[model samples]
Target chain A: MLPKKVKKRASLLTIFLLLSVIGVFLILNALNKNILYFNSPTDIKISQDINYNKKMRVGGMVKKNTLNINDQEIRFIITDFKNEVEVSFKGTIPNLFAEGKGVVAEGKLQDKKFFIAERILAKHDENYMPPELKNIMKENAE
Target chain B: MLNYFYNSNIFTWIEKLTNFINSIFFALLIAGLSFALVFSPPDYLQGDSVRIMYVHVPAAWISLASFSCIALLSIFNFIFKIKHLTLITKSIAPIGLMFTCIAIVTGSIWGRPTWGTFWAWDARISSMLILALFYLAFIFIHKLVSDEDRANKISSIVAAFGLINIPIIKYSVEWWSTLHQPASIKITGSSSIHSSMLMPLLLMFFVLIMYCALIFLMKYKTEIIRIKKKNLKRL
Candidate 1:
């Protein structure tokens, strides 16, 4: 049996910490949209209050075979499997931006179907390996 | 029981521990650096740019871990009313702030090559900036407040509130989409990071932990000395 003072403080801290953790989750749950940094194409399509002229971000995989590039601009379609947004950007994109890879386009929604991107940022998945190991893994999958 | 915390007793032990740590620190740092810079292979996709993870990841870990330590000590001090606990927390704050800054800087440097921008006001990045702000508030509370008791009380509450942000930072990637990638390392379940890269990352993390330990011990020793000097003046 421990002293009451030790026990009291321990219990108090535990309660305080639990409340803080639970409180955060509740607050985050309520303020989910505020905290979410970017919206997927599906989010844009579903949300009712979306402002077309207001600049926003739409992140999703660069749809395969939809990329159409020219000297002045690059056009591609981003998809979340459920929905898709066509994005057109004039600026240079990141090296990692590729078809069938994660990409986040920042700009204005031209309409429900088209987005004018001011900038394109590449998003990578969690996997990390050397080129040789990545090649071996790819070979195994094939 | 109180005698265990006698300043002179703790002070003497601090000296020996600091010296022992100093002797081994350089060797470990050299090994860690060599493995991080030379031995580690380039990323399959990211190539050599991924090497920045050696400093960036460890600093991020240290900053987060240090905040948790400070918050725990603060709670113990408030409950147990232990002056020794306050010393420990106070010693930890600056180190936490330093590493928090390091993590942000190194992360941004790593960002340019990958994210195309040095900074973005995304959830993960913004929350981390808020964390650095919390550290500043914790340190400034102690420095600016004249009454030691009041300072401790205020700082303890501040740390408790700051504790809420820890979970936010950790889950930010998962809770929301951001420019930052999801964590590759995990405490439970399988990690996505390869063993070859993991080795150097762990080595660098160990070296930074040792560095933090050295700084904490030295700062703690000084706090004890300051208390003793104050006591002698009262006589």
Candidate 2:
């Protein structure tokens, strides 16, 4: 077995490491609700802690057939399959924002059902493929 | 023992290694760039902009890996009083900071077309920014602190503290809904990225690792020289 000094130091180091890990875990845990960058439609719909008056973020897919575009104002419904939040924004949307694509919008919650987005950001999944392969997958899906 | 530990033999080795890396670095860089910019197919969605991943992903990865390495070494050195490891940590800190900055900038550039914002205070982005600050703190403490022993001790503790942020950065996407996309590549599970893109990305990562090696060797050699100079009058 190791000497007493080495063992003590080892235990000391272990304690410090454990404490640091636990401390960080607690800190991140406490900040979990605050550090969340955006909320899904379901989160906004369900979470009672959310302040409706404060500016916040809601993110999800641009629901199919919900995209209604006119001059200066674009209206769409963002959904995460469980709940939907209607978004109205007057800004230049990203090139990738399309119906049934992921999107993140920042605004104040007017109510649970409608959101006015000051800034709209597109979101994409991790998958990357060539257009031909993508088309084949789309065809297969259809 | 001190003299032997910092002997000239390692200097010769460093020189040769630097020369060897210099010889092959350009060829590998060219190949990696060509693969990244030309050979790899554009994403079905992002098109040519996806090329940014070749640099951004690798740089971000190296920065994370470097910080972890330094933190581990620093912990050991703080415990064991290993002088050589301190040298190694010092050499690595600048490189880590550089790559962290590169990753942040490249990621910002990639965000415009895809995410529609140059910057956001999202969990992932904010956490990475915190990482850069940690790197800065680790590096600047070394440069600004007057007492070497104190500097090393404080910096080691700082690095140990920053170690916690590593996982936070890694899991920020899944833990919190963020604008940043989740990782496409996984160490254990099957990667979502296709082989074509992955090849260039790995190639670029290899080349950048080589570049980091070159920089690290030079910095280590300089530190060795600086130490030897301090002892020159005695000799």
Candidate 3:
């Protein structure tokens, strides 16, 4: 058996280890609580029953016929298989941004379905060349 | 009797002072985390999502700060042959690893809301990922070596090399078109965050620093005891 003094020291060390682990757990929990998260068009539809004031993200492909480009606001429809969301934004659209492409909109919920976007993120595939150009290159080789 | 002898250890004064300092830092950390929770303002753009900055920024900052501690300790160990410095570094590795993981996890969570994706190869994000890996590698190496002297030597060399990643992580956003935002609060820079947001962030940052300080000191104390026990066994 270890001496009483050694046992005391070991117990002290155990307390520190426990505190450190608790500290990390608390930090992670705090982080999860504070950060908002992205949802697909279908996911937003499911979450519509929950609190709407909470900040969130909606992601989908921008529908081809949905973009209404006016002077200041560029409104569009984002759609997943089962649902679609109308997203309105007044900012510089990303370079690769266009119809029939993946886009994620960040902002608030209004009318239970529409998302008022503060920032619109347009996602592009690794190839910078347009899909049409990529097809053309393939066609020429073939 | 036993209590008297234990309390009268050779470094008792140093231990007392370190404990005092550790307590102060621990208090500040708790205060900061709580303040950040209650008082931080909503973002004009991000709304509630802005609060993620409190945890995310501080995690990133302290991960870098721990590396700074490691680098400094590594240099001291190499130059002065200070066994205490190596002990401090070993004590700090796990804490650093935990913080780095927090920063990455929080950053990803925040990104999902802001950038529409959970993961990215953006320069800032990738460099931070590498940093997390470096910390893991350091811990792994520290564990692998059975010899105390050899472990210290190897880990110090690793620490020295890992210091290079710190600058890269800091400057990656500035150098590249990254989804990650630039520094909101720095020693130099006009902060764009409103006063309400700024206060909580500062408070949380202070708390994280204090947390790191407290853990480091506690670990160092444990290390000293461990070394003494080993010496006693030899005797």
Candidate 4:
């Protein structure tokens, strides 16, 4: 048999490792339940039984010329190119909210085609190419 | 040999190096702040409010880095039974806690203008709050325990366990839908942030890291001296 002191130390280390593993497992499982996945318009279209009442996120490019801004509400069409969903938000949209930009709207869906966005988040492109370089690329492509 | 290295010249050399770096860091801190606040270009989307990133991002980065260091040091202490490693861990805890606090507060201020709310139960923000709590618990365990050896072991266990939160915080934005933006600075690929804005942000990050190292070294040295004096008294 191992020495009593060595056995005790080994058991202590085992217990600590087991506790850490269990704690991390429980925390990640709990967080997974609460996480809201951002769905593209295509995901929303393909999934037939999406819960309409629960709040969800719909992210896609804002279709060009679909924006309708009135004093009371702002409306736009978010498209994944494969499918499109119309979003209407009453709140003041973010400054980056514009046609053809990427956007994520969070709220309940009135239907598959209609989304009442409680919050509108403008998502910018990750590219940070200089304007002069961008012009050069555009000319080369042309 | 180890005692000679510790006694003869290494400590003096470390002190000199620390002083030199500390002076350079102070100058860089002032210059970086001025450049970040006044000279850097306003964000294309966020405007002047983006200046907050200079402080908030670096604080967040440093706190994560500090916890990672603590976790690694805790492991080394466990394996090698090194007293100095635990001392370093003790010295780092309060500094990490302070940086976590700065990150949270500055993030709240930045969120108010950008996200239109001071706070939200978003994934990224909540994970950061958990990190702050871990730092608090680490310090609390150290304070509550009377025996130095017991305190060190317990706090090290806590620090090792809390290391799980670091990866969660880093990946929270990507894994879940959150108001907080995705990382602007990519590790392997090109950064999303413009070079004009990134330069000042990087400068501030360097200054803050140097500041953390200086404080950690000073605190570690003091702890070592205190321990030595206590041992002498017992003798």
Candidate 5:
């Protein structure tokens, strides 16, 4: 028969393991909505009830020749090739923000087709290529 | 190995080494801070406020390293049932918590000037906050549980459970689109930061590591003495 101390240790270990599993499950479940991913134009397009008030990120390539620069606002079109959404912002954009580059705009959706971005993130790759240019390079290499 | 360490003069040697390093750490800290604050050029984007990176980054690094040490010690203690391992883990917790607090506060101070806000629910900051909470839970478990062996068991379990957060914290900036900048130093490639700025940052990192070591050694010595006194009383 196991000693009393040994039995106590075993039971404690079992309880600890059980608690850890439950804790992980609960945390992941709760964080599912908060752990936001960059929604493609298609994802935003297909969704029925778009979140207009909550801040969300939409990521895609800045469409070439669609960028409009004025003294007041900078506007561009973000496309996932299948669908496109117009984005407008007014600020000093990141140095990497250029046409035909991948960008993630963080703000609320104005409607199904328009996004008013509070912050424009210029997404880049490891090799210093803008994400959109990197994809194009890959496609050309193939 | 445990018996050898207990019987030999290793702890005394560690004490002396840490004492020696303590003086060097102070000297380097003053010099590093001067160089970082006065000598280093202001960042183009952040201007003078970027100097806070010298303190915030190193403290964050040390806090993460300390937690990694606690997790590793907990694993060894659980596997081998070594009392010394548990004692060392217990000693490191408070110091680790202090470093985590420094990182957070300094980060917030830095954020106000740069990010225009003290706090955001960004992934990197949130994950770091979670890590600090785990450290708190570890310390609280040790205090609440009266039984020595049981306390060690539960605290070690907590430390091991908290190990999952370290990777999440490290990769949070890259994995999520956060306001926090991506890591300048990459393992496979050379650092992207200029060498002029990198020098003071590296020196400050060394100073913080030495500081943590000196504190850890002192705390571990105190724990050993307390355990010895308790054992004597029991006898």
Candidate 6:
């Protein structure tokens, strides 16, 4: 059996190791709070005030029939299916960026609910479409 | 007996101090998000799409470093027959995998604004995807083997083999047609990024590196503790 002193030393080492890890974490946190994740649009709307100049990503689906294209400026509404945010972009649309699709727009908020997008992204699932879409086509023919 | 009490008190104090300070990962996560959110200067050309670089670059760096650790640990285990080395490597798999996922997701998000598409099977993207797959394979093999010794040997071999792809991934942009931009920060040459933007980017990278190191150390320490306990219990 190991001596009591040896056991004590081992325990102390473990404590020291753990403390060192936590110490590093705290030092970094004190320097800058970079780890805190942002909330979705719904959450952002409910909580603290957002600055007009500050940039953030607001995620949601495009509301049906809200997109209006006027030469350079393209405007649309993003809905969490509960609350909607108006998003305007002054650039060419992303290739996958279609109306009535899920999008996450990055930009600053202007007037409440108005987001002037610096960038717009389209999100899609990784998996391929099942045979169900084809099966539906066959059923429609029958 | 007196020495024991004194030592115990020291240990307790250390624990309290660590708890009070908070985790490095938490700090880094906050610093990274905030710096990226506000202070980082916009790109001269891409504008705000430049902001995505804060998250994308750090995540990619972490993924790369973690894989390097895996390769090193695998080699160590293979050469020295260290029992805990493989476990440490295995513990890092999830962290590496998560970093890779973050890199891919953030890269795709950045790509949409700049490249006009969420994805392209460009050289860099394809290589990152393959790296992620290699990590997945590591996780799968670790799960497959029942015998500890055999598992360690096989997984170490697999990890060593996976190292071959890291260079290909790094140089893919130069070797293939890619929408992904070539390296902005280069060795043997000055960085393409301007000084105004580079400072915060470097700061953010440092923060990310610290966080990754802290987490890896924590995970590795925990794995060692758990394995020791299991060995003790078995004996």
For residue A42, model 6's alpha carbon misses the true position, in angstroms, by 51
Which whole-number lDDT from 0 to 100 does residue A113 have in model 5? 92
lDDT against the true structure, per candidate, is 0.89, 0.90, 0.71, 0.82, 0.80, 0.69
Task: Calculate DockQ per candidate and list them.
Answer: 0.64, 0.76, 0.03, 0.29, 0.12, 0.03
- Score every model by TM-score: 0.94, 0.95, 0.60, 0.84, 0.76, 0.57
User: How would you encode candidate 2's per-residue C-alpha lDDT over B83-107 as one tens digit per residue?
Assistant: 8888999999999999999999999
- Tell me the lDDT of model 5 at B227: 83
The per-residue C-alpha lDDT of model 5 at residue A52 equals 95
Chain A TM-score of each candidate structure, as shown: 0.89, 0.93, 0.64, 0.69, 0.68, 0.65
Candidate 3 residues lying further than 4 Å off, grouped into runs, are: A1-142, B1-34
Candidate 5 stretches greater than 4 Å from native: A1-33, A37-48, A53-107, A116-142, B8-11
Give the C-alpha lDDT of model 2: 0.90
Residue A27, candidate 6: Cα error in Å is 48
Clashes of 1: 0
TM-score between candidate 4 and the true structure: 0.84
Order of candidates by lDDT, top first?
Answer: 2, 1, 4, 5, 3, 6
lDDT of 3 at B101: 93
State the lDDT at B168 in candidate 4.
88
Off by over 4 Å in 2: A1-6, B1-8
The CA lDDT at B44 in model 5 is 43
Q: Write one digit per residue (lDDT tens) for candidate 1, span B1-235.
A: 7667654567678778888989999999999999999999999888898999999999999899999999988987777788878888899999999999999999999888787888888889999999999999999999999999999989998898798899889989987988899999988999999999999999999999999989998888889879889999999
After superposing candidate 4, which stretches have Cα over 4 Å from the reference? A1-33, A37-43, A46-57, A124-142, B1-11
Interface RMSD of candidate 1, in Å, is: 2.0
Worst 10 residues of 2 chain A by lDDT: A2-11
Which structure among the candidates has the greatest lDDT?
2
Location of the lowest summed lDDT over 10 successive residues in candidate 4 chain B: B1-10
lDDT of 2 by residue, A9-31 (tens): 66777788899899888988898
- Whole-model lDDT for model 6 versus the true structure? 0.69
Clashing pairs in 3: B29-B207
* Model 6 CAPRI quality: incorrect
Supply candidate 1's per-residue lDDT for A37. 70
